[model samples]
Target: MGKATGFLEYTRINPKKRSPEERIRDWNEIRLPRDPEVVKTQGARCMNCGIPFCHSGVLLNGMASGCPLHNLIPEWNGLIYKGQWEEAYKRLTRTSPFPEFTSRVCPAPCEGACTEGHILESVTINSLEYEIIEKAFAEGWVVPRKGKATGRKIAIVGSGPAGLSAAYYLNTVGHEVTVYERSDRVGGLMMYGIPNMKLEKRIVERRFVLLKESGINFILNTEVGNDIPAQELVDQYDAVVLCAGATKARGLDVEGSQLKGVHYAVDFLGVNTKSLLDSNLQDGKFISAEGKNVIIIGGGDTGTDCVATSIRHGCKSVYQFEIMPEPPAQRIEESNPWPEWPKKLKVDYGQEEAISLSGKDPRNYLISTKKMAGNEKGEVKEVHTVEIAWVKNASGRMVPQEVPGTEKVWQADLVLLAMGFLGPEDRIADELKLDRDSRSNVKAEYEVFQTNLDKVFTAGDMRRGQSLIVWALQEGKLAAREVDKYLMGKSVIK
Candidate 1:
């Protein structure tokens, strides 16, 4: 450790954020630049624990407990404490291919598992990571480093985090990688699923430019199974890596779901981002929430993003519904002890903005929508909801029991279903006849990443259901290793 007693001397400090009122006016990121000295002080708070569980990257009690990339947290923290910014950046990039994205968006499971967090506040690992990478970019330390050509060709389907990470590593190992994206832009989820207020599109664009210069090829507006035959890729490339994310949105099964003005959260967010990038949102090509009372179904990150985006669109009123009960204000020490991800209440940026604008949290817990009421014009007008109680049924399983006489109708001009994804779209699976698990995810073993089809591999949300960007990166790296080995009889990717 750089400072043995640094944990006791310093409390956790996070980066400054733009005020809710000021930031909601535009689509820029909410966080302001953090002071380098302050970040160094925060980095010093890392304790010299005998077993650094923060780097374990394990899932405990159904929640992530540490960095999925197994980042060298303590090493880089010590480097930053000693004012070695370049060394810290190097240590960061050694494991993480895209700290710029993770630093901005990842929920920081590493901090949740920090040794200091058991008794006191955890070190600001996420902010410190962002600072290190940003400094590296400013200092021109991040440049192209291409490996000698291996003369082997690989095709990566999808250009999201998983695809990009696989392309980066496989290219570095001297393989010819071509990433295919159906959209005009690269980043799938990062570009569209997430709002710009959290991760700016320009950040993704910067990485895309660097990746292109480093020798990877990007083919945009090309759908693999539809636009091009899936077998053609298998015939042309030595191996095919499918990082196409789980994008089939789960639909609300209630009545009136097909009404106009009702949409999936991804569609709503994607359209807005595409329009914004095309012309700063001047073309008005997206579903508008302006002056409309909005209802968002679901209570995860997607729902939060919908709330914030609707607010930015100048919505009249917004309401978010979560089927599950609210989490505890603090971790239940008796059940969720140290090193397990604390199941606690967290007010994300979108919730903060909603609170500022509406003078309320805008979230309704233990609520489920019954149906949507439509106006004569076929647009959504009202949402009927019911309170539910989780009670044991005859099967001895907890099931949602609707409370009698608890139905209420709320005004809703636009309803966005932010429920999670089901799995990857069936187009590719059907075209390639790839085996799928019970959950409909591509059937590929972890670490091996090989599908039943010869020379075909799958990773990320396509293999494992919808998950975090960090997990996608991990899968991509692992899959790239397997692909390299399959091509060259063995791999040295790690």
Candidate 2:
């Protein structure tokens, strides 16, 4: 829907970013300014395909096909092509509540599913989205719409993207909303787990300030299961939406796992980032990687962040291990297609920084740690590792099989386990007596978002396993709609 020849004429161009050396020195966002017209040129690359799979948000054949929120991709692109920044921004907010967060951290599944991405680089939809949202914010076009009173009260748990999104919509509908967070801060994982280099805390704080100004109540250090029981939440508010998150981290069962130097990635990232914010490097209160060889387990975003953080911490060296084999640089023909997520090797920002700091990539794929070696003093001294290969099982699913002679050892003074999460904590589910899905997430239907317990609901990682922030926000919005409907017997929100 952009210019007739726009997609054919212009190539994709991403916004310029500050060098890794410069960005790592401060906690600000890693981006530099981009010319608006240049962003429009990038937006113009969106081909007007009959089926825009970018908003599908579902995994087809193990790949993401579209935008989960069904964002008006082509319409916005068309507006931007015509230099309609305000219109483009308006269209964007029609679906996503926080375009700024998606612009920074989202994997850009839309670009992966773009029709043009089959042979050439996808349209710079991500950068375009970023530009539109930022412009809207800059122009003061993003003001809270205080609606006429619906006179409903809603309680939302865990102030992550999901809870925040729900509060935004519910508040817009004039439902008095109170968000409760167990942590001292509002953002659940966003405030702590994610490193500042990826998304600066100031950005989150800025939006939080807007939310507060918009009349949403934020109650920090209030745990639903502890400070206030789930039943109290049910009695105190008309409806409750659980966005408690999949916080229980997965762990390694190997020898010396409990060594003093080994720490959970969440705890490590949280403490380190908090320390950075509270006292910029002067008060070395958090865990330090300075002048030490660090070993990180797992290869997801958290692991990558640990690698990047370790580099910034002035680590002597760093290593990351993933049990699965490295993915292909391009999509697999058997499963992936032009309109589906490409299963490819992606170098995220952290990996890029790690490569720049170290001589080569810090990842050792298809490898498993057999044991953590420690001195008699009980602090981690080294780690024993083994490389492995994959073989198709009877069901044709690939499984890791270790190579007998591939065992090796690496020396490390500190160990960080970024092995991902294990769904929601047991305490919440057990206390509420809520049913769980096979994945151990709360058993709640999509859009319905209700728990097994009467008048209780769930959203975000607690309902679905650990997922993208965009997915969490969508789930939160949908869950809030369900809760609102249950409380008021029908909702304008979908």
User: Best TM-score goes to which candidate?
Assistant: 1
Residue-wise C-alpha lDDT for candidate 2, range 205-292, written one tens digit per residue: 8899999999999999888888878878888778888888999999999999999989999999999888988888678889999899
TM-score of each: 0.99, 0.97
Error of 2 at 82 (Å): 1.4
Tens digits of lDDT, candidate 1, 310-338: 99999999999999999999989999998
- Those runs of model 2 whose alpha carbons end farther than 4 Å from true positions after fitting are none
Cα-based lDDT at residue 473, candidate 2: 87
User: Candidate 2 at residue 30, lDDT?
Assistant: 81
Q: 419, model 1: CA deviation in Å?
A: 0.7
Alpha carbon RMSD to native, model 1: 0.9
Candidate 1, residue 392: Cα displacement in angstroms equals 1.9
Q: How many backbone clashes does candidate 2 have?
A: 5
